[model samples]
Target: MNWMDTIENNNSVEPIEFNVVKVDHNISLAEAIQLSVEKSGYEVEFIETFYGIEMDIKIPFLVGTEDDMINVNITRDDYTITIDIDIRRPNTIEEKLDILEYVNDNNGFISFSWNNEEELSLISIWMSRERLDAVDMLLEHRLINIEMGNAYVNDDKELIQEKLAQRGELEVYRDEDLEFNLSGEWNATHGFEYRYILRDINELINAIQEERENILRFT
Candidate 1:
């Protein structure tokens, strides 16, 4: 699909024809933001809603203070990049997510969602995984399968044995703690918790970008 053409069709959105003859494609966030607002003579705000990304930049009440919660802090390890996003809310998350998702191309290995005494916190850090990337991924999905091998036996099949049968391949990892692996037995199945581990996605993308140049700045 021609995304540019699609954006042009929207009534609320229009394009800005800038003299990109010498503009660097990789402009800094602060600079790009400045240019975007400058294009409107500081009258209109700029937001990019391309693809699945939605972001908006609006001028404050010209004097009154407001909270700017979306903050991205990048730190460096030996061979990993930890982009810690201080998430506030979904609207807050959208801004940072859009920037990082665009920069990383939505290929972070370790993607996780959890609240850290904050609002709708979703932090994703990318690291370099070793030779176990493939196996780890397989195991991850397999674990999910084992957990949900049965779709509420009491609610549907009601065949615990059939559901437990799916754990044959995971016999090696089976044990007392994993008694529920091949068995449709839950440790009191009441609540469901969905955790997002962004490290895995980050590592996957980082490994894919192993040969690419990246700025690993330390602060």
Candidate 2:
């Protein structure tokens, strides 16, 4: 058909749609990110220039007493986005530092780790600016990714003392026993007696603050 006929018949272009596929954690990182965007309320597309202009953006958060903060950084890499996070805590609280972080890169491999050895536990995550918001907000909900920490357990073993009650030929028939169960299936599944890992509560707030400033530098 002639080009004119194609446009006249609304055939010059066709609607575009994507197929939904299901699979395990083996998809490419790009595809994984694209899926997140598509699943979200946002649409993914390549823009030559935003607003036909180029500028810098920055964000800031408070770091009070090192016990209140969080830092999120999103940077662009080629066509992908890198997410970086820094979870900070007060040195006073580090006396009991026990944490575990889980993260997923793209969908499978491609992740890192960081040990909070400054006696002031800190967690960090880094990625592209595009996925910054998704990741930053994700911090609240948590996204399984590179983790370098430990979570305390009831490992605080406590002695279990119990007295048994028994009656034999002397009286009648009644018996009782007692025991203690710890470090078993109950505390192994991720969340059973595992708390937030920090007693400061506000410590993460500060680490994220610095991260916000870092991310804002990109916006």
Candidate 3:
């Protein structure tokens, strides 16, 4: 589902935080990025750094200042590569839709904040590439609504669904066993409000990788 429908339908809301997705380590960071940008009708130049590689991927329609471009940071550690993209400037509706569609087609996730004008506001989409040789990515690292929350697993609907499917009843409780623990509250209108916290995000990412069978699932 798209953001507009989801935002309008939700009775209550939480603060929008950065979202992350993981893919396998297949192509080099440089190559994968180059292909992604060039295929999107943008050109990229990589700057090698002591820590890793950096690139400012430029979209023709998005060019104005350096801050308007998409900044990509790549670093390799522990047999996996992480690529983070920060959209420095606010994107138009069309641009946002195009970028989201492209990333989804490429088996990646894009996260960003939304200003819905109504009482609803927060938005984040964490679409993980469930396979090997895929890039692990997070989008929109902007910090907003600081008082609301700062945990990554705030979006725990999927986890809740899995539990319900297995147990036949919603076990609404704090699952400390998971790297990301979930806390629950009873909402009179919404029934149950579950908040997910990233107790150890790294552990979650590694576990996702271990659970992936192969790239064929994605293909």
lDDT tens digits, residues 55-134, model 3?
56553322112333444444331112232323322237764564455344543332332233333322222322111101
State the local distance difference test value for candidate 1.
0.29
Higher TM-score: candidate 2 or 3? Answer: 3
Model 3 regions more than 4 Å off: 1-27, 63-67, 77-219
Winner on lDDT between 1 and 3 is 3
> Model 2, residue 31: displacement in angstroms?
13
Provide the TM-score for each candidate, comma-separated: 0.19, 0.19, 0.27
TM-score of 2: 0.19
lDDT of 3: 0.31
Q: 106-207 in candidate 1: lDDT tens per residue?
A: 343433333344434434333432212222234456632335553331122322233344434334334433321112233111101000112222233343
Q: Is candidate 2 or candidate 3 better by lDDT?
A: 3
Q: Residue 51: error of model 1 in Å?
A: 37
What is the full ranking by lDDT, best candidate first? 3, 1, 2
On residues 12-55, what C-alpha lDDT tens digit does candidate 2 reach at each position? Answer: 22222223333354333223323533553334432223321111
Task: Show the lowest summed lDDT stretch of 10 residues, model 3.
Answer: 130-139
Candidate achieving higher lDDT, 1 or 2: 1
